[model samples]
Target: MALFRWGHSWDAFHDLEREVDRLLQSVNLSLSFQGLRFGRQYPPVNLYELPTEYLITAELPGVKSEELELTIANGVLSMTGRHISPEGAAEERFRRQERPRGVWQRSISLPDRVKSDNLSAEFVNGILKIHLPKADEVKPRQIPVAFGT
Candidate 1:
């Protein structure tokens, strides 16, 4: 009888170990999937700046010009937009989706004083362009210096 009892206890321990192993495997799989999703969600953006103006361009294929909103406040420029997926496209079937969709916002600090009222934005093809003109005081000017001997 003692031998039979030991055999039953051993089976119970083995079953418990298998359950724990399965739970651990599921957790690891979930973490891996999350990491992959995050990597494909956010891509890099390019910004350009000149001596008198600031220019920003973003790749937004299939996004309409009217969908984007640009604003400047307190020396910061913010760009917000949404990219609608193509019609009849199945989102779940995509093998790789690097382009970000939904409402996205990017804010950058102005390199110089900018005339927010005169800012302009245009979208052509797949590029979204922004033009920010510098304020009068921030523009470079030549000043004559006199030396008194």
Candidate 2:
């Protein structure tokens, strides 16, 4: 009976460990200090790869295009900008502030080298979509298979 109890406890501990790992993977590793998430970037992003190009979509609800800066260097694409708060809210008291404000920079690594010159970006409906064309050498190709007798 004791051996069985120990085995159940060990399994429970492993399950808890896996749950913690999953939660950590989904959230940004940021330290909360003084009611502020320091060194944390707002607006989560999603990246997808199509047949010809790679698409990166980021959620930027209140950020304007004029305040955004996009750059790609060393195979990493970076988007940096500041979220403008209300013009005059210094004296206002907030009940619960969930939306992140202030300057943020998010960098994503690319799987392959892309054509930077032909890259296109569009911001519409609070979503920023960037289309990066894969280089010719990196694009997949199908070679004709010659079956010899």
Candidate 3:
């Protein structure tokens, strides 16, 4: 009944890990980050499909129209932007930085080909809207059946 006991080394290791996490969280640092890709999907977006087009909307606070990049190729739409800290404010002065403060990029695939020439986008009040018009071949067409004359 007592031949084997719980491992003390494993428990000690976990305790040390918890302490390290606490210290890191207090300072708000990325202990495993290797650049700006901090494992979070920034600028969360929503996709909607309509009868004539597809719409994509995203909330991009602190990002201006000139600061964002949008591109579509090979049935995929990509968005990139950066959020900068306030002017004259140092990083050390930030008590908490939950929002990303660097460049972030995200991409999504389209269901079908879209009319690139007819595409439109608008940015107003920190909101981004992109309209992807459906291509001619992809649009649903109504066919009338011939009736007896």
Candidate 4:
């Protein structure tokens, strides 16, 4: 009777393991499909905001600066560009491919009101830097406060 019980328990444990493996496989498939669809769209970016101004830096290696487009409209800053992988490379086998290719657009919100006309962008060393000057009225100022007796 003890041997019979042990055999039944082992079978139940194996069944549970199989179910877990199926669930994990389904999740991985879903993620792969989503990544494929996203890669066809825009690439990812990193945005940084400071006290006096907003700074935006995007990674665009292997792409010319002229190929990028930066635009500011209605307080939104947009960076769009395309990074094409090198052709004729025989090593196509990829262990992991998280970096996105193709065309990508990234939009960032300013920390404070900014003068769109005064904005400037520079691309150097595979990094796109954008400097947004804050509006005069929105800049931080020290105000004197009178002590009440």
Candidate 5:
């Protein structure tokens, strides 16, 4: 008379699947997953070593020049900035927000000492370029040898 009989094992498997789905939804892969949440690598940068200077370029989309701060100390170059949310963004709920927001910082260690006072920075088209002139002692120089003194 009975067509089929489902066992308790089927119910257990369904429960396990539901739990896995819930766990996945609760985790924000971009921020945290393991024991701790990792900091984001905002405004990824590239460093170029030249004969006389060092060039550092960073992509800072959605961030303004006024919101940025640059400093160098102890052979380290520090960059601090804030990315403000768009106007009226608070009114809507974001299902998935990935862009960096709020105050963030990044630092890069210089291979050699740089003239901080003479350094310059420029921001254009959402890209930041920094020019750090190498110190006198760090710059490679050629020595001339005299055949007869």
Candidate 6:
């Protein structure tokens, strides 16, 4: 009876493993599950709206300025960059790798209209900061009400 019980437990374990494999396949992230993905669209970002301008920041470590590009049009901002892998270590095996490499692009819509030509970008300590000035018509204005005499 003990041997039969062991066989049943093994079947249950195999069933669970097959279910997990099916789930991973359904999501189409089997490479992510196996840790073999070379480039992933990642690198978190932050966006903030100031009184007169919008501030955008992105974390892009180990990326060069020449490899990055930025574009703004029709209230939409786009950023593209390449995260190059390290040199001479391509043959080395990795036990655990999480950093994303290769080209990545991200586009975000601005909350308000912005003056695309009047913008500035700065990269400091692996952080890219962008300042986009709001359009004149989009800036808030105070309206005064006058009582009829």
Best by TM-score: 2
What does the lDDT come to for candidate 3?
0.75
lDDT of 2 by residue, 14-90 (tens): 66655654565457445432223333345567779999999999988887889999999888988899988777676
- Where model 6 places Cα greater than 4 Å from the true spot, the runs are 1-41, 93-96, 142-149
Per-residue lDDT of 33 in model 1? 33
Put down candidate 3 lDDT per residue, 6-124, tens digits, no spaces.
25656766666556555655666553242222333666677889999999888786688888888888899898888877899887998976655788889988888998778788987
Better candidate number, 1 or 3, judged by lDDT? 3
Give all TM-scores, in the order shown.
0.60, 0.68, 0.66, 0.57, 0.67, 0.66
What are the Cα lDDT values of the candidates? 0.67, 0.75, 0.75, 0.65, 0.76, 0.74
Candidate 3 error regions (>4 Å): 1-40, 142-149
Residue 97, candidate 5: how far off, in angstroms? 2.5
Q: Ten-residue segment with the worst summed lDDT in candidate 2?
A: 1-10
lDDT of 6 by residue, 16-119 (tens): 65566556556666356232332333556678888889999888877778999999888788899887767765635666666776788888888888899998
What C-alpha lDDT does candidate 2 achieve relative to the native structure? 0.75
Candidate closest to the true structure, highest lDDT? 5
Pairs with steric clashes in candidate 1? none
For residues 1-149, write the lDDT of model 1, one tens digit per residue.
01112245478676665565556555554333322232232223456887767887777777787887778899997777787877787979888765556787777777778889989888789787888887898776799999999
Find the 10 residues in a row with the least total lDDT in model 3: 31-40
Ranked candidates, highest TM-score first: 2, 5, 3, 6, 1, 4
Q: Indicate whether candidate 3 or candidate 4 has the larger TM-score.
A: 3
